[model samples]
Target: MLRNFVILFPAFVSLFWALLFMMRWKRNSRSQNIWAVALLLLSNSMSIAALYWHDYEDYSLIYKLDVLETISTLSFIPVVFLYFERLTGVKKKGQIFRKILLFIPPVLMGGSTVLFYLIVGEERAAEFFKYIVEHDGALSPGFYEYRYVYMCINVYTYSAFLVVQAVLVFIYAGRNILMYRKQLDDFFSNLEGKSMDHHRATLKGLMLFLILVIAIAGSGNLLYVDFGFMVLVFLFLLGGVIFYLCYHVYFISYSADNFIMELKLSDEEALENGYGIMGEDDFGNADTGNMLRAKLLPQLTQVIEEDKVYLQNDLRLDDLARLLHTNRTYISRFIKEEFQCNFSEFINRKRIEYAQELFRESPEMTQEQIAEMSGFTHASSFSRVFKQCAGMTFREFQKGH
Candidate 1:
């Protein structure tokens, strides 16, 4: 029963998540499709672990399952990279080819496995397997003509590929997230829901998963000796990580695309304009800069400070630009130059200042009341930003006052 469960648990978890993603595809096909396919492959690959429990004499079935597992392992990092790309809203031109390139390792590795089995023939393949099993995995290079090729493709090459892919994905995904957060700061004043915190958590989970995978793969001998107990542990970890990511991705209502669409801009245009409205032709003009400095800067200050537009909970850069009858690019630039902060920081500073004023006027006001009145959608956000702007927590500041 334990052995059966050891084989079945990961497969069941993978299948369950795959089905969930499939069901959700209609509502969110772009994100769900890749995840569904990945989990499906994972479900199929779990059968490879069954070999440790019972010596199945079926060489062809074993080879096929091994190939599937190899393909799944090879594709894991790339799938993670794509998932992060989706979450971070890092849409770029010609991504199709780049994504295809990332999967090339899996394709090549799978093909090589198939070719190895065909070339070795069932008799020799079975013989090789029996020898490896009997000898405690001591390789006899002289016994198999293509032993080195098999080892390279199955072990060293794939391990090296996984490490390289993990490093690259880590670097690039992190960079994309940082860039996304910066973009959000420039585009919206209230980043309560748009902060991509979920994505960051998923990324951290993915890194831990990769490290576990690499460690287990490196210590492959333990799986055979421990009767695949480590595989069960690995799968349990995998299920936990998958559950975290799947649950978050499933319920996450934030769509970077929808937010960009709300701004009424295309991805390419948004990228070029830095999520603002000014075209290349209007940038870096001494006259335009001077005019914005003299007129637009004061107007921005007046609208935000005097008119108290920062009290609007959903205030955004585009809304301010529309009100000022100017492009967001100009306003964004002016905010940076005049206040030395991005739009989010400038507006949140104003909101924090307003919160301070309220705190003084009505010291009995609750945190939630002050947050709502000061244009923060959440008390938690208001408190966090208050501490950031005021260098103390609300309670501490109130006590001082």
Candidate 2:
């Protein structure tokens, strides 16, 4: 265990730091929480491996470690599903089936353990450990046969799950990219100046890096036939590189300082005007209604003032964050806290509001004209949001107003 501890210490440390970083985001993000839990489980698996390395001579102990490994491996599936759900904005209908799938590996392994105990009994279990210790790293033929079957089952199940997850990830990523590209094309076609160029470059880089990372991870897994732990090490290193890119290149290069400064100014203005003030302490502090209002007002103002930007054909949180010179996490938090809406709803609300104003002021304009002028790519979306928000059909609004 000590020898393997030294070999595995770096991985454990990397995972710990990753978990810490994730915990910060997890407060406001379901996806981050899922990933954090998955990493923690993987860390547990590593610790179990260390224990097994020390007690490899004990067959019973080895079997118990194997059971732990199976459980840890299965835990990854739900995390993957949750990650995809967040990435694609898809909601699970019940999630009961998914939960069952996640539990299957552990249940099977536990059942096997019970069966082993029944066959060998408690005394034999102890005797078996002593016999293996005396035999010097050699196991009985029956044990080898059982272990081989177990390993095969694990490999097949894990590989099948990975394949399913990979397919889902690719599909989700593709849809997001397509939507993002369409929005960029629409916005860039209208806007000019360095800001637009900066946005374009940033989006391109972010999307490219995401695709590259996924490709690398998939390829690394496939090459496990030869690489084994080397591939896993490469993945760990790649994750570190991604963290560096996100912090230094993406966040810093975007100049989030401007956004933070703006937020500070807004806070001061709100306080001086007796509007509201929101404070987040380093320790656990309760959130107040005034503070919530204060934090949300600026974001709402931005949406109203920058309606054109928000009405992009393929708008997303990342694109909005770049435009605001902030991070996606901040944007997501603002939408949830202030508007009680998701990113899509926040953007749609802006579009609908713009359409409402057009319909009110430009009474002579047709529904199609108003929708187009209000930044809606289609009149259908305009009508849908208009009815939902205003509680009246577009024709009714036009007629009544």
Question: Which candidate gets the maximum TM-score versus the true structure?
Answer: 1
Model 1 C-alpha lDDT per residue in residues 1-401, reported as the tens digit of each score: 77677566767777888898887687873656776776777677665655644666675566567777788878877887777677667777877877887899899988988898788887777666656655656565656678787778877877777777777778777788788888888988898776366767766766776676677567654334434565567767776776776666666567566666766663344455554455534647877667656777678778877899999988888778777766777777778877899999999999999888998999999999999999999998998899999999998988999
Residue 126 in candidate 2, Cα distance off native in Å = 7.4
- TM-scores, one per candidate: 0.88, 0.41
Candidate 2's TM-score reads 0.41
Q: How many residue pairs clash in each candidate?
A: 0, 1
Angstrom error at residue 217, model 2: 14
lDDT of 2 at 251: 27
Candidate 1 lDDT for residue 51: 69
Residue range 1-401, candidate 2, lDDT tens digits: 44454546634653765567575763424544555665666566556544433444556565555556556644654554554344324334655675466556556655665465456665665555344444542344555534444334444444454455445545544554345334333222222221333434433443443454456334522321323366456445544543442332222221223334444665455455543422233112345545544665676577558557755655545555555544444556666666786666666667778888876787899998887776666677678778877888999987778
